[model samples]
Target: MTRKYIDCREFPSEMNCTVAISADSEKELLEAAVQHAVTIHHHADSPELRAQLVTLFHEGTPPTEAPRTA
Candidate 1:
């Protein structure tokens, strides 16, 4: 199966978090991303959150580091 990932730096947040999450499957990636969002970002877990995250899913593994931001 193709790997998938989600990068926090893609979204602008108060913390400017640099975390990048990846998994061998979409299900795994979603679960881990949800946990990170709820615990680290203090976001409420809900269907809406999950939907939004789905849109952010990226194919393949994340880069070794987050892209540089100005």
Candidate 2:
């Protein structure tokens, strides 16, 4: 399976967070992302949050900044 990542910089937030997390497996990435969201961003951990985060996953390493739409 391909490595997956989620970059916080890509999302809008009050802190303008710059964290990016990656893992070899989706399960690992999801757990880490959930923890980061709950602890650092003070977001509630729930099914909805997990669903949203899953949609945000990208293959391989995260870009320094969010890629621009063409």
Candidate 3:
């Protein structure tokens, strides 16, 4: 199966977090993403948040460099 990933830089945040996470499966990706969100981003853990996180997941590993901002 293809790897799954979550790129923090894709989301708008005050910190402009650049952390990126990848996993072999969706379940693992979701768990790590959730933990990172709650701990670093101060997000509340819930089914709703979990659902939202799933939407942010993408196939393959995250990019090595941050997107160029204009």
Candidate 4:
């Protein structure tokens, strides 16, 4: 697992963010991104965000959670 730090300082200027993870494939990247979001950004990342991150990092698929049927 080779980790990379993506410094998105050029685009989305407001976000002074850095993503560090070992993502060999597309799926890994998405998972890492979500983890980064929840743990660091504290953002309840939407599915759209997950998809975008997948495209950006070219890694893992984001895991889907089943809706709670109370």
Candidate 5:
């Protein structure tokens, strides 16, 4: 199965976080991403946030090169 990833740098945040989460499935990625969001970004856990995160999900492993901010 293909891996999934969520890059914090892709999202808008006051912290400008550079964290990137990966998992074997979307469900796992969502769970981990949400926890990181709540704990590190001080975001409230909600369905809306979960849905937004769903849109940010990408297939395959995260890039080893630095994330592009522009």
Candidate 6:
């Protein structure tokens, strides 16, 4: 069995989170995401945030900061 690691940075104030999960397969990644959200964000099982976390992980796109035009 191969274990994977997911780098997650959650910001509750911003209502945005960044998660970089790397697993042997998508299945493992999803599992990890759920656990992480629950433990870190205090999201109980079947919470909406869990789904959102999974979606963010699956999307595989990091959050980007907009440039200031000043």
Candidate 6's TM-score: 0.47
lDDT of 1 by residue, 3-68 (tens): 999999877789889899999999999999999999999999999999999898999988886666
Q: Each prediction's TM-score against the native?
A: 0.89, 0.87, 0.90, 0.50, 0.88, 0.47
Off by over 4 Å in 3: 68-70
lDDT tens digits, residues 1-70, model 5? 9999998876567777888899998999999999998999888999999999999899998887647776
Best prediction by TM-score = 3
Task: Show where candidate 6 strays beyond 4 Å.
Answer: 1-7, 10-19, 58-70
Per-residue lDDT over 1-70 for candidate 6, one digit per residue giving the tens place of the 0 to 100 score = 4644444553333544555557766577778778776776677878576566555542333334421222
Give candidate 2 misplaced runs (Cα > 4 Å): 65-70
List runs of model 1 lying over 4 Å from the truth. Answer: 68-70
Which has the better TM-score: candidate 1, or candidate 3? Answer: 3
Candidate 2 per-residue lDDT over residues 2-68, each given as its tens digit: 9999988776778878889999999999999999999999889999999999999999998876755
Clashing residue pairs in candidate 2 are none
Clashes of each: 0, 0, 0, 9, 0, 0
Candidate ranking (TM-score, best to worst) = 3, 1, 5, 2, 4, 6
**What C-alpha lDDT values do all the predictions have?**
0.91, 0.90, 0.91, 0.52, 0.89, 0.57
Clashing pairs in 6: none
The weakest ten consecutive residues by lDDT in model 3 span 61-70
Q: Candidate 3 versus the native: TM-score?
A: 0.90
Worst ten-residue run, lDDT, model 6? 61-70
Error of 2 at 48 (Å): 0.7
Superposition TM-score, candidate 4 onto the true structure: 0.50
Residue 17 displacement in candidate 2 (angstroms): 0.6
